[model samples]
Target: MDNRSYFLEEQRCVKKNGSQEISAHCDEELHFDIPPTAAWGTTEVQLREDLTEERQETLEDTANAFQGRGRVVRNNTHFCALTSCPRILQNKKKGKMGVTFRNSASEGSIFIGKRTVKDGECCGVWDVAGKYSIIMGPQRKWMMFSRFIFMDRLIADSHQYLEVRYRNGKKENKRGPLSMFEDPIVHESIAVMNAVTVDAFEVIVVYSEDEHGNVKRNVVHGPTVFIPDVNQWLHVFRWHGSRGKDLHEKVPGALVFTKLRTIPDQFYYNAEGVRTADDTSLTVKVMVFFQLTNLEVMLNSTHDPIGDFINALLADLMNFGCSYSYEQFVQNAQQLSELDTFPVMCGRASAIGFTIGKVVYRGYAASTQLQNLCESAIKTRTELKLKAEEQEQRERMRDYEVRGAHGRGDAERAEELAKQEHQLAMRAAQHQESLKQAEDAHSKALRQKEQMAQVELAAKVAEEQAHLAYLQGLKDMGVDLTQYLVSKSEKQPDKVLKVVTAPSHFSALPINSVSHIGGLNIHTNV
Candidate 1:
């Protein structure tokens, strides 16, 4: 048997010549044969059959890959088409002005210096000739063509607001992102203005559209979100106007430029009223502090909210004043500031989106008649106090006098007691001395009696000794002693004589009988 082989292939390519494109085919195949020597032989062949649609699609994909093209549709007719050369805008100096415009007249139609337009071109040079309109397109886009314009001294300080006003009446009020440009947009329809800054210490009632298409109202402190379109209207209500200027004299219009900071409004009123109870008249000075709370409500409720608030405040003050007498009003004047009487007033203002911060009673002056009565009352109180003090002083003096008299009496009594005790002591000492002297005299008398007794005893003893000596001398001269004794007895006849006989043995008794015999009678004491 002989070996056989067959192969089929296809290829496609895209060819280009300058700007022309052409599609062509490149396909080849080969057949192999064995000769008698068993060597290999080859034959080239070209296929001429039509390809299937699927195969043709594959061939087209291969052709596209070769051409280096992706599957995206693009139109080059209107892509950056310009009729003439684009002029590069010159950079403006820091203090110069320019004009800008946008052509929204037609599609592929732009105006440049009144020249005729060509086909498939959309841009042209714009200068200070016509009105600038933001071209609205099918893509809902706006286009502006302009050069930069600058200002010499368009500064917005921290206390100033830079306001931008467009020709369509939209406004932007801000404080920061500072620039030295009056009108930053190089367009004839726009202008740069000034406004008082809404500082952080103040609030502004702004009317704006919300996401739900409702006209929303709220307070804004300082700069709000920025918007550059000229489709919205704006107005600012401030407590005060620009510095060094009055509110009425502040330039009006949406584009007027006056940089300032927001401050709270303070209203001072000097009013007169008659008290209800006493018919007394009073002049009062009061201060009112207030701020705007909502722009839409404020504008809707009244044409002039500030003036309305002041009038309402005065009415409320007078109403409150009528409730009390002159004295009561003077004493309770602070009640004017109380919110009790302000509810009705506050309600009227709050309907217009205005709030009262505070109300201060500055001062009040009464009539001359009331002043005289007050002075008299004060004088009376002073006199009463002085009288009470005088009475207290008199009582204190009387108490002092009583205490001094009691002290003097006590001193005198003490002195008298001391003197009496001293006298008693002296008398006792004298009595003791007298007793001592009497005892001494009694002792001396006893000694003298003893001496006298001793002398009498000595005299008796001497008399007895002399009598014995005389008797002894009589006994020694014994010549007639018996006779002498008898003679002496005779001479003293009254003297009794006694005779004594010696004791004999026969007669031991009867001595009296014997003495008689001896011729002498002797009376004897034996």
Candidate 2:
């Protein structure tokens, strides 16, 4: 057979030797053969606003698993009376043991109530469970408040604490008939709550002192820091809030925040009662920018830091203006830029916790009579320069025309030489051709003369052959042909006859009566 036994984490079983032993906090059952007597009990403990989840559970028994446990703490209800601040609520718990509120500045814890806690006891033991209420108070010196309450209940339930703190000179005032229960305010260095938020343009300086007793500084730029009391280990220094606009009144020992930005339209000056290098006076307007830097150091250094910076800037500008003539300054007025002013202004402003950013020359103008004279001089100079340039250009044109005429003369001479050479070559070719034709004609004439002479000689030879043949024929016929011809010629006197008087019979009869000489004798005629 098995015997059943159960216990909780906050429960401790007492033995005969007075030593104690604790049990598991879960719903586990142990089997014991002897079935020794067992009793259930609880511990009484105080939970601060910042206690962790694991540590809080150690102060409770296994009875915490019961439904609706530890729900009656007041500060845990998410109640805040700072009317200027907005609240955002999100309920994330589920089932019967759900969380209904949330706030970082104030918090609460659960309890198994109706138990008397001893002075040095971290927890109290209880025989039976009872109703629980909230117990809340400040844990830092800067969190001290002279008059703090909500919905007619004491803010910290410290009536006796107020009277004690008031008599100690730690607080200036106390609230109501509940002043008898107060305690002295602490954390004079300053404490900030997580409920506070800082803007992007703002900065919070956590001022304190080091171990050597000198002042120390910690900077917070925001967006925000969630917790401020966690940094109270250092001593107090100084605080400044909201550089842009007024947001909160001075809260003693609270984190002070402020911003850094440019202050515009600060320095507007008209240049007057000052003469330039040329003794010409002009009107000039200028502007500048100013910002805060080491504010804590500045307060101790000077009563009016901004005024000192402005005066130094104007004095330096006056000196710079004297270095340039009226025309020179107006022509290149932009030379009076930020680079020229920052160095001089910063030198004087460093003692006042201010920084110089930019300087600008807005505008400038001269007197009307002086401006007219300047304009006339400028126009005259421009006209003279134009006339000189025109004369130079005319000289260049004359030189070009002369060069062009010389080039045309050289080209014409070359063309004439080429024409003469061509004419000489054509004449030479014509002379050679005429000489060849004359030679050909002379040769033809000589050939024609020789041909005519040959034709005449051939004709003479043919006539002589004919004559000889004729004479032979007459001889062959045995006729006296010469004599016949002579007789024939004698009958025709116009015909001439040549006679060879080798004197044969033909010659002998050549006398005038040869008519009958060959046949009949002519004795009577003789």
TM-score of each: 0.32, 0.27
lDDT of 1 by residue, 14-90 (tens): 32334544443332211111112222122111222343222322222232222321221123211111112112112
Model 2 residue 493 CA deviation (Å) reads 99
Q: What is the lDDT of candidate 1?
A: 0.49
Worst 10 residues of 2 by lDDT: 26-35
Model 1 RMSD in angstroms? 31.6
Clashing pairs in 1: 194-257, 194-258, 197-260, 497-522, 498-522
Badly placed stretches (over 4 Å) of model 1 are 1-197, 200-229, 238-268, 274-276, 287-299, 302-309, 331-334, 353-360, 367-526
The best candidate by TM-score is 1
Q: Which portions of model 2 show Cα errors greater than 4 Å? A: 1-198, 203-273, 287-291, 302-306, 331-334, 338-343, 375-526
Q: Locate the minimum summed-lDDT window of 10 residues in model 1.
A: 77-86
Residue-level lDDT of model 2, residues 1-526, one tens digit each, is 1122222122232212134443322111111111123332232222333433322332332222233312222333321111111111112122221131212222222232112122221221111243222223211111111111111122312221122123333422232233121111221221111233456755555655555777667766677632333222322333322233332222232333233322332445454555578888776666666667776666567645544554675567666668888877777678766556446677877667776677777876668898789789889988998999999889989998998899899889989999999999999989988998999999999989889888888888888899779888888999888797788666433323344455565655543332334444332211
